[model samples]
Every structure is written in structure tokens, then in C-alpha cells.
Target: MKTYLPQIERRILVRPNQTYGILNYDLDNAYPQRMLELVAGSPTAKDCWNKRTKFIAGNGLEEKDLGKQIINAKGLTIAKLLKALATDKALFTGFGIHINYNADFRITSVSYVKFEDIRMGDTDNAETADKFALYSDWGRKTWKNIMRSKVTFLDKYNPEPEVISEQVCKAGGWEHYKGQLFYFNPEVDDYPLIEADSVWEDFETEAGIKIFNNREVTTGFLPSTMLFMQSRREEAENTRPDADTYTGINIPTQLEKDLGAFQGAKSAQKIIVIEYEDESSKPEFKAYPIQNNDKLFETTERSVEARIIKGFSVPKELINAEKSSGLSNGSEKKQAILEFNDNTAADRLELSETLAEIFSRFYKDINPGKNWNIIPVTAIAADDNPGIKAGNAINELLQSTLPRESKIAALVYAYGFKQAEAEAMCL
Candidate 1:
């Protein structure tokens, strides 16, 4: 009898925007306008993310433009463009780039496109997955009047909806073509945009918390309410009436007039009041003052601060901010700092790789086989006592029975010592 083997079922997961010739409704429904609004309105989000970008894009990368003199247009340079990219990425959680080159093999210009204006195109093929088209609200402004106008004032008040521009790129070509739709495909090595979906919510939340804190701080954190007291309406009718006193005016009406006058005055005055007493044996009065409740939200504020720090992936101690948990000892604090530096180094490497690939592609298109190098500089973070660490490593190598010459060479190279100096130290 012949035996049959069972085959395992498999599935390949792709980005939400990627579908095999099928429209991705989820990505289409992502309400980017609101997301952009949320991020744009957040100061904390801008600060945290921008700081990271600034740290990674320090001084920009060194590049060989192949004598194209591309940066001359509008006094633009690689560093300025990189800074713009960093800022766009921080604010929009994505970066969009437009490369302009001439037919004579020269990279004429590189522009950092706004993320809000980009729409992802065909993703069925890896070659075309990174393709996109840009939409804009330019030339949509209209004149309107408040009353009896052909265009309604409300239409003017409302933001003009973005419409796709004519400019677009197709797959496997450097030529840009016009299109009515908001999508296009490009056969590029990698996507023209780098996006982070997971961190977007964190950025929005951090921004919202910061806005709330700012508002609270400005308003003097308090609970405000309205208080109304029904005063006795009966007037004190003296059996012996006097012309000196006036009882015709209502207490509430007089109070309102006094308040309006006091508020309208140019000079500041303190301790003003409209005193009123009822003729009834028992009088009633009530006051509602804004009660401060800052202490109640202190914990929430701290928690939000911690979350914002974590979202930015920064070391709190670096900014002189203290965390409520862990990191108790000196070693722990040191480790925290080291970890932050490591993360920064990793970011630098990743950014450099991406920038190098992009520049290489652009440069190669203009001048085939030309040199374009993008190097990211990162600071070295070693142990608190490098001498001790080196000594321990050297001792370990010695006990492992490594060659004397190899050990001496290692000492000289690792510790940045001269050959003679290392030899004398080893001796």
C-alpha cells in the first residue's frame, strides 16, 4: 500500500496596505486627516520625536554628488534635506521623498514630501509596493461672503478637501506622468516612504496629555461650578419710612450692574462686593468658588510623563527626570544610560544604511558606478572604568592560552596604545 504525506497549511502576512490585487479597505479607511490634526496639535509629541530625529541626523551624512551641483537649486543641501526629512518623520510618523533627475544622468534635486499628501499605490508586487502618489489642497481656496453670496461662508470656514495632483510616477521608470486618481506605482528598491503605525497612537496620546496639562496649568487646576441662591424677595418695610434709603431695586439686578461696572473698569480693584440682607428672620446665602484639585491629577500627570518618555525611547536620567520604579542603584542608573546610548547607536546605523541606499540609487541613476558614501557618526559608550575592563579581558585571554604576540597586539589595538607602549605594559 502507498502511504500519503500531509502538507502543512501556510499563510503569508503582509502590511495592512498590501493586498494581492485586492483593495485594502482597512488602509483606505484610516482617517489620516484626523490623525494628522492630532499629531500637528501636540507639542509634547513634536518635542520627543523631533529630539530623536535631531539626535540621529546630527550634522547629516557626507555624500559625493558626482559633480552634479544638485544642491545649488534654492541653496539646498543634503544636510538641510535630511533635517527636513527628520522633522517630517517626527511630525507625521513617515517621510516621503521625491527624487528629480535629468536625462543626462544628473540628480537635479531631492525634495522631502509631506506624508499627509502621499497615498500608497500597488503593493501586490514587491517591486511596486513602495509606489505612491501625492495629493494636495493647493488652488482650492475660494472667495465667500457671510450673507447673500454665491459661495457660502460655511464652505470657506471648512477646510478644503485634498485632491490628487497631476504629478505621479509609474513602475520601472524615472519619468513622472499626470494622473487623475490618487495612486501610482513605482518599481523602486525600497518604499519611498518610511512609516510607523504602532508609534502613532503613542505620539497622539503623549500630545493630548501634554495639551491637557498645559491647559490645567494655565487655568490653575480646579473644579468650577455655578451657584444660585434664592434670596428672600420680601423687602424690609419700615413702619417709619425714610427717604434716605432706596428699596425699589432688586438685589440680583443691582449685583449684576455692579459686576458689569467693576469688570469694565480700566484699573484693577480688589475686595468689591454687593452686600444684601433680607427682611426675613432667617436669611440664606451661598457662594461657589473654584476649588483647586491639582493633587488629584498629579499621579496621572506623572504616569503620562513616563509614558511619553518611554514612547520616545529616551533615558529619563539624561533629562534629569526621575522614574518612580527600579533604577535604584548607581550601576542600574549607569546601565540605563548605556542602554540609551546603545539604542541611539542602533538608530544611527539604521538611518545611515537607509540614507546610503537612497543616495546610492539616485547617484547611480545619474552616473553609473560612481562613489557615494553615507556614514553615520556615533559616540562610543564604554564601561565606567575602561582600564579595568581591558585588564580583565587581557587576563582572560592570557589564561585561555592565546599566543603572546596576539595578546600584545590585541592590547595595543583595543586600548589605543603605541606598539612599544603596549609591549612595555604587557611586559
Candidate 2:
């Protein structure tokens, strides 16, 4: 037996290099980069990633101005920062924020950093990383030279104001002190695995299947066909005696060019005109009756898609609206949204808390007491009236003993009426 496919081996060996004083993310130091490419190549993975990012970000902060405040000179607001963090978190399960401080050690500006661009500095302790290395191209494919100016060293985020103040004072100014980095990794002592890491091989498999189909189509779907052509007497005689007389290389070369012309969709229904002087020199196409595996390919692709979506914890109802219909469609999607919201609540809370902590130090107006909540997906009225008609639900609400405000709330949420319309009907 022989194997044509590569064996799957997923491991994160955080090898430390004493020479560079930086730890390698996997053996090649390009795990995140490779993961990024995988996500880009797989449609299901990319869709789930976008859905996760959107769900985690939700409707932005409850306090609108707090999110509107520009965090950097480039006009990157807190909302954009939250979205970027959510994007990275959805993909890498970790995110980084570059914080710049003034001479007085007060946070001046903050910017979102690509998680793939960051590498942990070599540390004796396994639990904590004191420094980080930020380079645009960790794979070194974009910038081969990797100049000293391209690399930046940043201190890990220290919450203690007094410690940062003292360090800045010792350095003589903020100019002397490099910026700080707030790296968020839910897992301790190791680089966090991507959300879809468990089904990562499925991503590759899906991509390979697509490539196979593409090649089949491009080559005129001739994978099962073998062409056998007899050599002409004159052509055989023309061959030099010095050359291998048994093998007619020039005959195969011309046949290859003829075969190449029969490739692509344009060749479909095209007539093949082969001229031969006798039956002995006729061309024969022997097609081995290979099993048609289109159904198998489709099933495998669907399984791969489902696994990828499951790995991201996204509901099929939310991703595939076409599969749902009738009265249950809206309700099913609504329930999925609610369930997914609950599943992603922790992610939302993590972003909220991280932002709250950082902003509390940067802005006096923003504090932990102020709610830093990312608004969840609200259920629409259509979703609320599952088996019941909208008119019946509204009539029942109108006849209830509930107060005007309560009735209005029911009309808005349960019957899918706009706030103003619900209020008017209640009045």
C-alpha cells in the first residue's frame, strides 16, 4: 500500500531560541501565519470566523461616546478597536494591544496589533512573558532582510501605575522607554490554539477537494481516460537508429498537443477529427470505468463544512437560512442567535473587561462602575410568535391585565412591532 496524502500532525512546540531571545511559535515560527492562510482558503472556516467576530462584537458598547472616543492619532475609535480585537480573538483566541504612554506614565494612545505579528520573548518562567517582539512579517517572506528598525520590543502590560511611573522616571522620559503591550491569551504557559484547531485538517481537506474538482474541470474531465495511438510506418522508419527505436518520443509529443487542445469546457461537444491511412494506425481511447464519486465528494464537503461550523460553535440555523422555511424558520434562527449569544457571552465579557481595565487608566470618565457591555442580538417579533399568528398575539396582549408599559414591551418583543408603534397601540 502507498499513501498519496500527507499525514496530519498538529503540535505546538514553543521552542525557545537563546540566540534570538525569542520563542518560536511552533517549529517554523509561522503557526499563526499558516493558520491565517488556512482560514482564507476555506470558505466555511472564513464564514464562521466572520460570524464569530460579528457575534462577539455585537451592537458595540452600551455607552456610545465611550466607543466613539478616538484611541490613536489615526482616528481608531474604541468601537473599531473592539471589532479588531474580536476579529483576532475569533481567529487566534488571543489579541494584542500596543499602548503608548506619556512622560508621566499616563496612557497616551492605544492601537490594535495583529496577533500573528507578535512573538513572545524567551523567558525562564513558563507562566509569564515580560517582553514581546513585534515584526510585520514573522515568516520573513515579505521583508527578507529584517532590519533592526523593523523589529520593536515592548514591555508586557503592567497594571500598577506606580511601577510604570518609576520605570519611566528611571528611563528619564517616555521617549527612552519603549511602549507597553497588553497580550491576552486565555490559556496560560502556551500559545492559545485557534477556535477551529480541532477541525483544522478538515479545512485542508475541503481545500484539496476543491482543487481536485478544479483540476478535473480544467483538464476536460479526462482523469479516467487513457489514449493509445499506433505509430505510422513512415514515421517509425523516419526515427534515427541511434535513438531508442522502440519508443517513438516524437509521436507521443504530437499526441500530447492534440490531447491538450481537447481540454477545458470549450472542448465539450467538440468533434475530434483524427485522419489515418489505415486501421493499423488508428487512435484508441480506452476509458477505465472509474466509479463516479461526485456524491462522495459532495458528502465529504458537507461533512467538512459542518465540522468547521461546529468547531467555531456557530449554529447551522444561523449560517444556512435557506434550509429553514415556514413559521419555524424565524423562530429557529432566533433560538440559534440566543443560544449562540449565550455561548459567546464569555468572549464578549473578556473584551469588555479588558477594555474597561485599559480605558479606566487612560480616561478618568470611563470606570469599571460604568457598564462596558457589548449589546447582544435581540430577538425580533417574528421570532417570538412561533406557532401563533402576529395578530392573535397582539390581541391577547391588548386584552391582558398588564400595565401600558408592559403591554408595549410585549408588543415590541413578542409581536415584532416597532417601539413607537407599540407605544401608540398601548396608549
Candidate 3:
């Protein structure tokens, strides 16, 4: 005797396509594109991704003027560039920046490149990749044909002035030479896994649950049922001209038309009627009652949502504000913001460091030193008195019978006021 059991296995493979001269991202070179679709289709995943992106970007750079300075001819500012990079980093755990150079071998303009549009060039060594391939329609569905002219090959970012000058000279000019691409993938793999990659199945499950509910609603929440009817036979001369001769009027077809009329919201709750000749030939309407799995679906959706949020390392309070209690909502939200900021500190730091290194070489008027930093949104949140409203606290303090000194002390200590300022206000 033999017993069979189902086994499921998943693997992430990086294969090189010699024709394209690029290493495929997870067998198809479309992992990032697939991830984009998955997030687009799933509400929870999209929410988590958005929240992660926003948190990572925070309030933009510490230097307001520097952030406002345009980086490219398109008027893309440093702040906008950072946000775009944060969006890709939150989604793909990687991002790419396209850098152009002038005749003097100096950086001229920088633009944000979509992470999904980039592919690492095929290389014998795993540690280094010299070239990067960029194509907008990797799916090949948008355009009739993806011609060689549509694909651009870019050199990996090299900071060495000598290398850039030599490459520019060899290519005959700066315009002829391809721009350099700054690819950031901190995960140390051929390609970075998406932030929510571990819970991708959960994303699919959540999307499936939504589709299931949509189908159920569209069908008026009807159970799967089978309709059986005895065929009506008539003499050959009695059959109508338009009737199906062999089936004698096609009762099943008529029944289907009648039943289809009752589907969807517009025709819901309408009575269904069937006529038969006698008890022996009565139509049997057998409903295979589908068990009400609303609760099961709800549970599964919640589980999948939780898993996706966890995979993104986003706090639950941030995504679903209603889940937190009304009394402690503010405090809980503040704590969640702080926690999320801490979680994304590394991401912000990486972006900040990369921008700092790149901008240090930019034109002197725009570059604001090597200490480029992005302020976390938590800085603003931390300053908030979440536990107690300041107006309410002041009202309570004023209405109390406490001495002036005591009130002033409370204001200084509890409300973060300077002692002199608190005393003057109390007086």
C-alpha cells in the first residue's frame, strides 16, 4: 500500500539571462513588479507599505532650505527624492538613483529611478556588478515590442574621479557615456527581498478573501444549489414551432433564465415559481447549503493582515487607529510612532548617509556639508503631551486650591516650562 501526502516548497532563485545580460530577479526578473501588484491589490498590504514609507521619510531633512534645493532639471527636490527613495525602500528594501555627469567629470543632476525598472547585469562574481539594465516595460505588455533602443545600460556608481574621466573620454563625451546608477540593496543578496516578502502568501490570502466576498455579494449571497426537473414529453404534432423538439420546450433553459433573473441586488428576495404536471413529476430544488463561513473569513483576513503588518515591521496602532482605546489612544499612538521610528532608524540612516555622500560632490551652493540628516516624525510626536491635554491641565491647575508656588512648580516640572517662565505666568 502507498500513501500520498501533499508537499509544498518555495525557493528564491537568481538566474542570469545571457540574452539580456542581466541576472533575473527571482527567476523572472519581475519579483519587484509582482510585489507592486500584490500590494496594489491588497488593502492591508498597501496601508502598511504607505505607513512604512511615510514613517521612513518623516518630516524630510533637518535642513529645510537644503531639502528644498532642486536636484534635477525636472525640479525634483532633495526632499521629494528622499520620499521617493523611501517609498521604494519600504516596498523593495532597495532603491536606485540615476546620476548624470558634466564634461568636467562632476555630478550635475540626480533623479529617482523606480526600483522595479532596474536589473543587475550578469556577472561571474557575486560580490560586484558593473552594469545595470533599466527598462520601463519589463512585463512587455505595455509596448508592442521592447526594442534595443528602449533599454538603457548604466554603469554602477563609481566615486573615483579618474574612472569617470577615463570612461567619459573613452565614450568620446559626457553625452555619449551612460549615466551612473546608485543602487542600494543592504540585504547583501543578488536582489533585495521586498519588506513584506515573508508574508506574501498572506497578501494573496487577504486578496482572495476580498474577491470571495465580492463574488458572494454579487450573487446575492445564494448557496450552491442544484435544480432537477422531469422532462416534459409531448406528441410530435403538439410541440410548438420554436420549442426544442427533443426536450419538448427546454424547461431547463427556461428555469435557468428565471433563476438568473433573481441574482444580484436588483433582483434579490424575488419569489421563484415552478409548475409541474403531478406529484411524480414535481421539480426538485435541492440547495446544498454552504456553511456560513463569514466568521472564518473574517478571522483569516485579520490573521493575514496582522502577518503583513508584522512583515513590514509596522505597529498595529498606526494602521488601525480604532483598535486602540479612546482613553489611551493618544499615548498609544505616540508610543507606536516612537517604536516605528526606532524600527526605521536604520533605513533613514542609510538614506541619509547615501545622500550625504552623493551631495558632498554636488555644486557648492546646493551641498550643505556631509552631515545630511532626515528628522524623524517622532520628534514632533515626542513633543506632544499625549497623556494629558495642556489646556485641561492648566485649567485644572488654576482651579485647584494649591499655593501659587506649588502651581508654578507643577507647571515647570510637568509641562516642561522654564522655572522663571512658569513663575511669571503663575503670577
Candidate 4:
């Protein structure tokens, strides 16, 4: 019995907020993609959901827009991870047995899923077993419900003879998962690197191997603590022409109906780009009235600009999407760049510095609401780079819902973070 075990490279980011914050992403220096980045036998889209330690991207909005966001974000990233497991479905999805590492060691892997507009995230941006328990419960309650025709069934009651272990064998107890390495914890408990597969191919091979290469990925939430897993499959099994069908810029269908006052030139019109500079942090954006005339926008609003997200306080006009009626023209002087130094990550991330400022501000704004007194998404939408878009996607991906006066403004933040992170890593 010759079993081939392909290694997976996992990439973990520190995501206190919704954005996939890269702590120390060292992909360029990692192992050769072919040497330690491919998984031989992986699960298919259908079977992947039945497992315990699986990832799922539910339609998770602010629990407020809970209704429609569900229709959009369902199965975004986790679904893709399953299909790219390995070439040999037999090897990839094989259940011959299992591997068990403890609590300190999670079964993590890396993929280009987050690189592009690779959205699709777990329900809670914060990871916990509870968020994923539904998948396990659904499978256990009615296995017959989700089983497909192409599924391989080895036996009846002995259907899962492929392995000695049952589903999730926890830290304390063990049932059918006896002879096998159920779980062993060095610090707390043990976790298995089950159906998950990790891989890395340069900017070259990523597109052809992905599931929905046609869609422009704007917003996504990913587990921040993932480990980088890498691997490469043979050309035959992994070969596929690069897909050019993806809509480069995704405009929600609903926004099409609501472009009322903001409709500029195209259905996706030009946005009012306003950039404010800060000595302490990255530049932030502000939205001006969409200039109907091109020649006018240059003189009136100036060229495009971006924001400094690390600042203390965002201008209220930006946060509320209030009309920038104050600045009638470039000459009409108003403090467009608001200063937020005494209170925020704008200064530093030290516990004493950050926390003291945070609590002090909490006391200051201890009124009702999360405080829309924050900066507007447009105030940060002043991206100068040809690539960044700053609206819902960036806010969603970055987890900052800065209000937008228009649909294009909304899409700016949604798409900006991807472009920003992409640029950051490419450098």
C-alpha cells in the first residue's frame, strides 16, 4: 500500500478586525511549491461539507442586513478550498485513516483564495467550534439528505470503513476512533488536519486552478490564525485554461436600481476621489459630489487621493456620508483633513497607549449607537493608486462599515483592501 501524502502550506493572519491582517507572511521564502504544497487525495465540493473541522462562508453581514447578505456571501471561500484539494479525487477524499495533532497545532493550509477578490469567510470573523458545529450536526442528523449520486459508498452500516475513526474525536473521550490517532494535546487538546489541503503556486498557476476564476472577488473574511500549507499537482490533473470570465469589478445587482442621484457616466460611474494626508498614518479618503464634467473634477476636487486608516478620529462628514457642502470649490478653505491624534491606533498600537486612548474615547462618546461620529468610507476612498477601490468590499473585508453616499463609493472600500494587500505582498 503506497500512500502519497502531499504537504499543505498554511498562511495565517492576525484578524482582530474583519481584515486579514498579515502578521508575518513569509511565502516568498517558504518551501518549493512542488516539493511541499500539494495534496494527493482531497474531498469534492459535495463531500467536503460533511466533515467536522470544515470552513464555511455563510452570508454574514452585520446581523442587521442579515436577510440579503445571506443571499450573496454563501459558500464563498470554503467551497473553493474543497475542490482544489488534490487531483486524484480518490487520494484527496480518501478516508483510509486520519492524523491527529493537538490544540496548539491546528490543521491549517494556505491557498491564493485570499490573494485576489477571494471572499467567502466563516460566519463569525472570530473562529470558534460553535460557528462550525452546524455542519457536523446537519451531517450527523441526516446523512442521507446531502449524499449525492457520485458519492462512494463502501458499505451499509459500515459505510465509513475507509477509516478507523468516526467524526470529531475530542480531547477527553474516544469512541470508534480508537486504534487511530484521535487527538493528542501538547498544550490544551488535539486537532486533526483532515480533508483540508494547502498549496502555493506563484501568480502564474493560481488562476487556472481556482473554482470561480471568472468572478471579481471584492469582499471576504478569513480565519486570521491559519497556517500556510503548500503543494502542487501534476499538469494533467491540474491543467485548465485560465478563466477570463470573471467580472473585474463587481457591482451588486440591487445597486443598479438605486443609482438615483449618484449615476454619473457609466452604470458604474466615476466616484468623487478625496485624499487626506496624516503624518502618523496611511492616507484616508473623502467623497466630494461626483463631478458631472471631467474638466471640472480636476480643478474643483483635484486628482484622486486615499486615506490614513490608522488615524484617531475620522471626520463626521465622511463617516455619515454627509454632503461636503462646506467645500464648494478647491479655494473654499475648510479643514478637509481632520486631526485625530490624542485618541487612536493613529499614534501607536502599544497596550497602554492604544487602550488608554480607546477607553478615554469610550468615556467621551459614551452615548447611544456605535457612534457614526466616526469617519466616512468616502473620507478614506481617496486612493491614488490605479488599483484600489474603496467601498463596501474594503469595509466588509476590513470590517469597517464607513458609510458611502453612492454605490461606487460603497464598492470602493469593498475592493480597496484586496488591491492594497495585493500591492503590499507583491512588494
Candidate 5:
């Protein structure tokens, strides 16, 4: 229904260039096959697959997932989106579904009904378990109409022409950050190879099975075929001239000027995450995408580590640091002694360590007890493209819940400030 699932759980098998937009010129006509199964729930595997089959793993029936042109026409049929154009890209661009047969199969059609997700039959009420996903008008019946209607096909001379290839996607390793892992290396050299997205490993025993970041869990993989290869390269880039070098790789005017300058912030996003206090450091800190564009460091040794967030103007060393960066119109701190009577002991101890590092940088991932973090220009990115800005601790708690907005726009990210101190820390 609303199944694009890739906030970091990825397992996709796509094959579509066009074939259901219904073709019946007789390759023998009637050659249809739709069998699908994809189950993924987070916030810790939907509490371990619903505390162990109390239920979850495809049954409620809301399995739509063929994005990049996200438009599901209900119970799918335009001939199943044009015989799924045999996984279109001229023929096929990706395929990989191995979580041991992947579980619970039976997909004869519903052209991805919205990336699959539904448990218990007759959709089990409460508005068919939160309705799931439908796109727009083209839906009104609900409860997936108890699955089973009518669809059959096989042609190219009664069943023969089937050849799909071009899949070997791998999402392996890196992104430990703290213990310092960091893989995916789109060739940023020095033997780093991140560009990741396929490293999910979650197991279960069954009995009221509870799974989600558990005794055995590893995350960050969301490549469901980059939303249908960016919707068939944006429908062959409208009419290519090179379609701006192929959709300019999914526009991001620098992430919409870094989330519109941290969502029109007045003041509160901060930076200065420079690390490496000893052991002959080297990766002082370098993250390139742009901004001068030729300095992406890493040369450490003493147990090495690296991170450098951006979006300056709130660096009183890092205010209270983390109150989960949430709390508004809110006020409740000056606890006594006449609120320190306009205090004056060396500028009131630097504004009370900038209000306790602004409550410890928005509550450090909501009250984590560790003393190490380095999110820097935060973004978990997985092919939707256009990200990499103002996630440094929720862009500093959304610029402390904007009460004085009006900075229209101003982001200086040369990979976390530096272009002349990010233009002297913007305004």
C-alpha cells in the first residue's frame, strides 16, 4: 500500500520497462505470472515479527513497491503495468530476492500494490489495518477484496521468451561511525568502498518471535532498485538530449540549500566536530561533494575516527547538546537565585555553556548514555538521492523549533564548513 520501505531495509527484485500500460496482439496472449513476497518492518522488525506470528509477513495484503513514478492504479492492471515489460531497462536492471525463498509467497498480480505489508486476513478491520496505501481515487473497496479474482497469461508461443539479467547488487560493510567502520567508497580512494545498501541479516526462532535491532541485527540497506531505476530514468528523461546528464542524478540544489537552511532557521544549528586529539592523527576530517571540491582526508592511527557536522551559528561548544532537539514555546530552566541576576562571572560562564550545549545537542539520539558521536552532515541515503545536509542531530533540533524564522537561505557546506570557515559561519 505505502510500501517503498527503504528507510534502510532493502530487498528488491524489479523487472519492468513497460508491459502493463495490456498488450494482446497474440504472442499467444494470456501469458501472466505474478508471484511476490516482501516483508520488512522496523522500529525493530515490527517488534520481532509481531512478537512471533501473533502475525506479520504478508497476508493483510498491501504490497506495492515499484516507485520512481509512484502511481499505483489499485489491484494493478493496465495488462499487470504491460507484462511488467520483462523488468523494463530495455529488459532488466536488477534482481535479488534471497532471505531463504524470502517467505510466504503467492503473488499472482496487484502490480506491487504499494510495496507489500499487511497481516491477518479480511485485512482485519480498523479500516483494513490502517488502509496501507492507494495513491488517489481508484480505490474504494478496501480489505484487498479478499485476494483472488482472475488473471492468467503465457505467450511468445505459449510460454518461452523469458530472459532477465543484470543483477549483482551488493550492499556490504561500512558505516560503523563510532567504532569507526565507514565503507561505501564511490571511489573516494584510499581503499574505501562504501556506496552501500544490502547487508540485512535478521533471524527468528518463532515463539512469539520478537525481532528488531536484536541479539542479531545489522541495518542500513534500502535499494529496492532505486525506486524503479528513477522511474525508468524519468521516462527516458522526457526525451533525452542527455536529460541533464540523466536527471542530474536526482536534483538536490545542495539538498534544497540544505533543507532550506535548516528549515528557515533563525539560529540554533551548530558545528565544529573536529576530532583526533592524539595517536598521530591524519584523517583530520574531509568530506567532498562540492565547495572547492578537492580535499577529502583520512590519515589517522591512534584508534582512528572521523566526523564533522555543519550548519553553524550554534556552537557555544554545543548547547545542552541533546534534548532530542524537541521542545517548544517551551521554557522551564532558570531554577533559582533570582535567575542569576543578569549574571556576570566572566560572561556568566559563557552563557552557562551555551545553555548546557543546548540540552546536550538535542538529547543525543534521545538519551543515549555514550560520550561519542559524530553524525556530520547527517543522512542515511539509499538511492532516493538528494540528501546530505542538516541532519547533524536533527539539524540541531530543527533549529530549536524555529520561533524566529526569516533567514530565507544560507548553507555553507564544503563538507561541513571550511570554505573560509563556511563564509565566516554564514549570518
Candidate 6:
């Protein structure tokens, strides 16, 4: 008989730094689609996005009539829809809106399509071409689920897969392709796609991938730290020993075995009894403690979290991150918050505009040849920094030797009111 020994495995580290070949990404490929789906489906990510969306949209629609339209859409609420749309854009850089209309040429509902389930053909828009092609796997359950069907299990030998269906929207009617049903909408001819950001696309890079990566790294901190053993203890004889020596803890073999037996037991308290071979000698206990080094981990976690917050353009203070500077005072912190809001203004404006366009199109489709305008979603409520500054200026003017009319004029200009109104208030 021949005996064989297990092969020794060696760890190898390869430095491919800046030497790898570029990888290409397809806009229509499933990788990006799957990634976006994961982000949208993740409960944590969903919550973060929902809160952020509400923060941007603030409460709900500013217009009462527009709010009514959203309420009528039963399945989805205005706030929830905005949150989904914002999350879609944040993760996929683009989102789709599907407008549903009633038979009387009135918009009855509005819905959103996840980027993953959307399939677009050669046409730029889904509704533009008379016979434009668009596919949605909304109700199509995976083949694996169908294969294990209790009713069809007996037919496993001849498992006939269900045919995939497609729908076509004609000029003013509907058509089905391979079991798909589509209704044509002549009022609007576009797929209502909203892109959150525009940037260069290359083989190894994407618009939102960096942000998602940062978020992942930030969230991994706790799990990674869980692997760190924070402390250790050693028991040794009462005699002094040289610090540099390799002497091990002095414990009797039997006593060590007993300690090992308590590996995973948990109780309110534990007592250990050690007996010495010398009947006259008493057993004593002492512990030499060791602490784990975690400065690197703390620094890395904070750095990653800051990067994540930066990617979202969210204020660090909002998330309770350590203050960037020593400014612990409220006024100083307010400035930081104001700066963050200012930096986010552009992105918020873009989201509002995108939402406005979708709502406008829905209104137009609902009421053809009617003059109606939908109010655009407002960005985060304006900060009162300007108002505070105006008040300070007014106080300064009052302290000066300027005439009453001059003060009133300054107040009128600063507060955007008529001179008479300012005088009346000042008086």
C-alpha cells in the first residue's frame, strides 16, 4: 500500500498595479442591470435612499392638484414613487417612468420600471416608433421555479418551457408578439428616461460604481472589525521572569485542560479552583493583559465613511460623523451644513427638473389640448442663511446715523417689499 501526503498550498501575492488590460462594459448588458437591481432591492440601501429622497422633496408635492393626481394612482404614493425614482437614478444613473391612462384619454396612474427588467431595442424611445420594441420581464417567473412546478413535475421527462412573450404598440391599437401584449400611446412617444448624472464610460469605469463601492466599504467596517480579537490574557507563576524570554504561562496540564473545556459556555459568573501538588501550598491567580492595536482600523473606517458620505453629497454632521474640524459650536456647524447644502444644490435641482418633466408629460397626456402646468418639485427648502444676513444688516443700519427713510429703503430692498410696506413695518 502506498501512502500519500496532503499537498502544501502556498499563498501568492501578485501586483498587477496599472498593468491589467481594460475591460469593456455594455450599456444594455446584464452586469450593470443586476448591480442596479441589487442596490434597489437591498433593504438598507432602499431606506437610505428613501430618507434622502424625502429630504430632497420635503414632505410631499407642493401643489395640491398634483398631490391629488399621485393619490389617485392607488398602488404607489407620491413620496414612495419619488423615493424609488431617486434611488434608481442614484444607483443606475437613469430611471424609467410608465404613464398609465384610462380609456377616456385621462391619466389614471403612474408607475416606475426597474432598470433591470427594462429591455430596449434599436429605437431611442419605447413609445416613439409606431412599432417600437420594449420588453419587460415583470410577471415572468424564472424557469427554475417553473421547472419545479408541483403540477408539471410529472411531465419532467418532457419539460416544455413556456414561450416568452412580447407586446407591440401600433399607431392607435395594440398587438401581441409571441404572447406579449402592448398598447400604443399616441399622446406621448417617449420612454421617459431620467438620467441623474452624465460622465465618461470606459471599459473598467462607470458613473455610479465608485459611489457604490465607497458605500460598500463604509458598511463593511463593523464586520471587518468583528474579526479583530481585541484583547488577550496570560497567566504565569508568581516568580518574576525576564520580559524577553520565551517562557510560556505556567499552568498545570490538568488545569489547562479544564480551562479549555469551558470554550463556549456562557453563564452569569464562573469560578475556577486550582489545586497544587503540595497540600500545604495555596493556588493563586494573576492575569497579564494585552490589548489589540486598532488605531489603523478606526482611521480606515472613518476615512471610508467620509468618502461614502461625500459620494452621496450628504453632510457628515447629518450622519453623526466626527466634526471635520474643532468647531464644536452650533454656529460653526451650521456653516458646514450650509456648505453641504450649497454643494448639493445642483444635484437637487436636476432631480426636481426630471420629476417636473415626467409630471408635465403625464398631465399633457391626461388632458389633450388643454392649458395646464404642473409645478416642479421644489429642492430642499431654502436655508435661512440669507435671511439671517439681512437681519444683521438691518440691525447695523439701525445703529448707523442714516435717516428713517434710508433705513426703510434698505429694509425694503433687503426683504423684497415695497417702501411703504417696509415703512409701515419699521414704524
* lDDT (10s digit) by residue, model 5, range 1-427: 5877558422332222122212221132211111110113212222222222111111111212211222222443322332231122011111111010001121111232211111111123332221112121112134443222322111110111121010101112112110100111122211111101111122111111323213112222111121111111113224556776786564443323443343212422433232334545423223334332112211211011101111111121122223211221112222211222222122223222322332232212222342212111212223222232234533453355433222112232223333443333233
lDDT winner, 3 or 5: 3
- Candidate 1 residue-wise lDDT at 364: 44
TM-scores, each model vs. reference: 0.50, 0.78, 0.78, 0.15, 0.14, 0.42
Give the clash count for each candidate: 0, 1, 0, 61, 73, 1
Model 6 lDDT tens row, 1-427: 9999998642221121111111112322234443445435433333334445544444454444344344234557655666666565554445555544333333344565564444333233233222212333322335323121221000001111231111213222322221121221111322322221111121113224445455544444222221112122334343555634646645445555555443322421456566455534544444444343245544544454444444455555555523222113344446545665455445455556655544553434432333222233333333446445655666677678888887788766655655555676456
Candidate 3: how many backbone clashes? 0
lDDT digits (tens) for residues 1-427 of candidate 1 = 9999998532111244332222221333224454555556655444566566765565455545543334435665666666665565443444555554444333345555555455454456554343453444211223222111221100001111121121222322335422222111122322222223335565566566667677655544433434355553544434345434755533345545554454422423534564556544333344466534355455555566556566667666644322211213345545655665556564555445545555553434543554333344343443436434655665676566667688678766665555665576555
> What TM value does model 4 have?
0.15
lDDT by residue for model 4 over 1-427, one digit each (tens)?
A: 9999997644432222133211111232111121123221111222222211121111111123212211112332322332222121111221121122222222211121111111112335433221111011112234545233322111101213232133324322333321221111111221112122232221113222232222212112111122222221112222235434543534333323342323423434445332224443333234445324435433322211111111112333333222222212322112332232222222122212311222232213222233212121122224333223222234343344433333234333433323333344223
Q: How close is candidate 2 to the true structure, as a TM-score?
A: 0.78
Q: Point out the higher-scoring one by TM-score: 2 or 4.
A: 2
C-alpha RMSD of candidate 5: 29.9
lDDT of model number 6: 0.41
Off by over 4 Å in 5: 1-43, 46-148, 152-201, 205-427
Clashes (candidate 1): 0
Better of 1 and 4 by TM-score: 1
| Model 4 lDDT at residue 62 | 19
Tell how far residue 22 is off in model 2, in angstroms.
Answer: 1.4
How far does residue 68 in candidate 4 sit from its true spot (Å)? 23
